[model samples]
Target: MTLSYRVLIALLTPLIFIYLWVRGARAPEYRKRWSERLALQTVPVQARDGIVIHCVSVGETVAARGLIEDILRSYPQLPVTLTAMTPTAAELAQKLFADRVYHYYLPIDTRGAMARFIEKFAPRCVLILETELWPNLLAEAKRHGAQVMLVNARLSAKSLRSYQRFSWLLGPIWSALDLVICQHVDSERRFQQLGVARERTVVRGNLKFDCQVPAATTRAAKQWRTELARPILVAASTHQGEDAIILDAFARLIQAVPELLLIIVPRHPERFREVTSAAQQRFSTLTRSSGQTVSASDQVLIGDTMGELLFWYAAADIAFVGGSLIPRGGHNPLEPIATKTPIISGRHVFNFQPLFDRLTDVNGVRLVDDAEQLAEQCLQLLQQPVQGQTMAAVASEEFAAEHGATARVLADIQGLFPPPNGQARTLKMILTSNPNAATEIWFDDNLATAVSDDYFAPSFWRQKGQIIGSATGRASAWFIQHQPQNMLLRHYYRGGLVGKFNRDRFAREAIVKSRAMAEFSLLLQLRELGLPVPQPIAARYQRAPIWGYRADILVAVIADSQDVFKLLLQRSLTAAEWQSVGATIRQLHQAGVYHSDLNCHNIMLDQAGKVWLVDFDKCGFRTEGEWQQANLQRLLRSLLKEQGKAEQSQQLFHWQQTTDWPHLLQGYEQA
Candidate 1:
């Protein structure tokens, strides 16, 4: 079956290019990036041995944003390569992640292209968002020993029957999946009916429900609302046939409420001009890209801009989720739900029928049958603000209840990446021994070479002219300028008065119980939990006869970051940044991590303003208890103590107890 399918794709290769050329006539971006489409581009060194996520179009890309961010936070050490089929989705991925992730066009699903892609990236895992299943792509990844999983997977009965009709071709492809994280139980059953093993499928809720309105987006929406004080109706992701119906509905809605404004956003970028032209034929229209301020007399606005759909939804008093007025199914209604906006949709929502059904059950969305009903619903919602608010409240509650899918999906993805020392084919750790000195070294196998005790010696780096700098604490930590990456080497030392007598010595213990080994293992566990922490490079223990053993560990430096203590000394953190810090701490606590010392010094803010927790020397997992609160209090005391010292020295410290602490707490509780 696979052979026949490949033969068919090979035969249609020319037609595929012709199709692309045809699409390029309407949207020129389709003709761009042919090298990426053919898997002809060179993979960067940093992107190798990482994870590849496939989001077919803009909707899938938007839905997968939360999941991708969680993946990045959990495995800060691993690079992520994002691939999309459409130009809009490609552009959206770039705008969303910027330089944080590698973006590329997914290679056409051919044997040669798939092989080159898999070999170049050498990805350890491939995650397919939603339902983009290509036979050769899955087979090549599996052939190269990369785990493949389908996330936010949904298969309606219609799609299931369609796949079942060609079971011979798709059965093996379905079986190739390491796991299928479904959005509904019905989807799980459909996948099982096809070919997936029961053990390999689990039903996690929809990721769209986990979508968050960014703080910046909320602020922008607030400004927009203040600018346009009149009632606003946002028609989002409209399709070709649906725009006419929506325009007709707006025509009728204006008779009842002349001050109401309609903002229509087309689903595809190529249709933006067409939709804008159509809306202008009926009412005074303004396109968002025109940079023209909207007047009170303007009744129509075209949201032609990309990546501002959420902002429009937030600014709207009522949202009409488009594509349903015609037979094109519908876009995600959860976007408006996340923004606490009332929703109205047409009857045809089979693409997300289960979700729509659930929302309808709770009176969260009003379903319309035609233009007449759509206008009626819009007028009713506009006239009765309290009714609209009540509906929005119910939808928001349901949306909030569906949270945690991102966490669940992260857990499943983490399961695919086993411990470095485990028998996982993806990552491996090497243990080198020196029987002569009762010494041992544990290091990542991906390192250039197997490290020895000499690698731990400061003199080893100093002799090679690799020592870049040093930091003062109870013991000094030396920074090494290693090729392709930087490293920090720290020797374990006893703190306080005990450090004066025996700075680096410890009682004899088993190798696994030693400080270096324990910390190394804990770091690995933390990475698996998806917490942002320094990557452990190598750890060693050198025996000192009867006295005990001395330990040292080398970890990769987090690039472009400073400890919060250092950042606060220079400038005050924005309210959002403070909240992010609190949210990050909450994530650690939720993961059962008990940082022996949770202080401002241990918290880091990267150049991108991502919060990171470091220095887990004595930290370990603990059961849920009062220690979480105590841990937070410790961080607060550290902030206060630093502020006091700075005041005495007449130095600047930018922390406010009332405002910043409350914002932090808000972020913590929300997270």
Candidate 2:
């Protein structure tokens, strides 16, 4: 080759490598940091069907430990593999299952990741500890001929509502499962409602009940018990924004029972420093049990260690489980119960309802409504040791009766992990015929058309802005089909593409059009229901600015009708319209749908002077008194926005007496 060409190649080689390095660094961080370690799973050959057990985290791993030992004892020749998602759980499994079972981190839920994982381990059966339902993981497992089952499954009511919203995504995943061994009847019923076949779902009481409480080290327990020389209250698994509430409660109990000792354990060990600082600031004398030394002067003791909750429970007079009192679902209360400690908890216990309900039914657990209540309950228990021990006895009895579910669950596992019968059915997925064709059709645009320019390019955004038009009014409309690489727009119609207007602002222009369409449609639907609402002619789902997911409703602008708040300010509406608005609010409240937002913007008026309501996103099943009070407060806010609070409050009180709530009561009764 020529000298110039040779020199050029030499210079560009290093540049190419640099360019590749930069590009690779810019790529999304796909591979997890610990994934490589997980990839070191040993493949078993000439082994019995692989026993794959999935435990979500530490608690689950601990619960499954007994079951794992049982499974191994039953079939020592069977190769066993354990998997966990969290790094903490993986480390815990490594320590517990070391040299016994193959341990690995679960792959990400992408089809490629799951495919690689299943291909490597070749597990005959997969047992998910709880409700770890990933769509791609389940689908690929079933596709690759692995039997799947959900063991120790528990579904809450709130979880039920969330799953209902995504039934489309969950339906196929549930179908892939061979069986679901739920924890309670309520959980089973919820799963059945979501289309999991009733026959496939079985109620196996919680494995936590079967967990053998770690025997307390006699020397250690004796030393701590002597050091305290008083009754101890153990607050286990406390979360952020909860320590203060628990501390306040503990302080109150301390006043009543002077010999009370408080031991607080936060959920995450990483927050040890922060919690220690807070404890020191709150209590005059605080002791951190990090080392072997145990001090007697310590007013509040902070549990900064790990895997010692059971030991602490064994050393306690009563247990107060955290992550409750606040809005968060409470942590597991089963440990305390199994330890035979009288349990006290806040209202939020959705996560451990079955155990909590059983404890409450037998008067073994105390329900504390707030911080004060929690402290009061703790004080009552400590002052009355006899009563506390009685409660603890009930807890022990309830837990003992619910044991032995692990064996029943193991019996069910054989059905899913069966021997190979014949060749497995194979089905190839056909994503597309044309390799370059756009896959996701959002409205009508092919996202590929926008590939030349980057997403944030000034020129691209300028063009996009122009296509959307000015935000003030309706400008233009376009169909956008988005792909991973780019976005595409289709300009022509199916029959005759006649309308051709602004070229620059198609994306910005769709929102006003969509909102107008939604508003109009809502009005039309309301009119059909014979409810008072503005008249509407047309409606459409706007498919531009927000990737076509949000459709705006539009209605004709009322000529003379004003919003009730605006009318009230001008004194424009007759007494009849005001009465109608109040009556309509009552009617809606009685109908079991409360306007959760309860804003005046939601209330509309027509030219004929009729009142209407909009926005169903925040609506929910609420009490009639709450809805009425909320709506009244909303009206007062709107009036205060226009006029002062004095004017709003004056009119509010006047209307309260002038307007007959009894007439509105009649409208609500009629509805």
User: Which segments of candidate 1 are over 4 A away from where they belong?
Assistant: 418-671
Best by lDDT: 1
Candidate 2, 209-283: lDDT as tens digits: 786664543356657888768788888888888888887886777677766778888776555667778878877
Q: Which stretches of candidate 2 lie over 4 Å from their true place?
A: 1-32, 36-49, 94-99, 156-161, 189-199, 216-228, 252-260, 284-289, 369-371, 415-671
Model 2 reaches what TM-score against the true structure?
0.53
* Residue-level lDDT tens digits of model 1 in 1-671: 37778887788877888888899987888888888877988665457667899999998999999999888777666678999989999888988999999999998888898988987786778999988999989988887678999999998888989998877664478878999999989999999998899999999988888999999999989998897898899999998899999989989988989998899988888898888889888789999999999999899999887888999999999999988988888878888998999999998898888779989999999999889999998888888889999999988886677899988988988887642433221222344556356787777755436576778889999999999988766778999998656888999998889888887889987665588867876786577667888887888878987789988898888888999889989999999999999999999999988999889988989999999898888787777899999999999999999999999999999998988899999889999
Report the error of model 2 at residue 333, Å: 1.9
Candidate 1 lDDT (Cα, 0 to 1): 0.86
Identify the candidate with maximal TM-score: 1
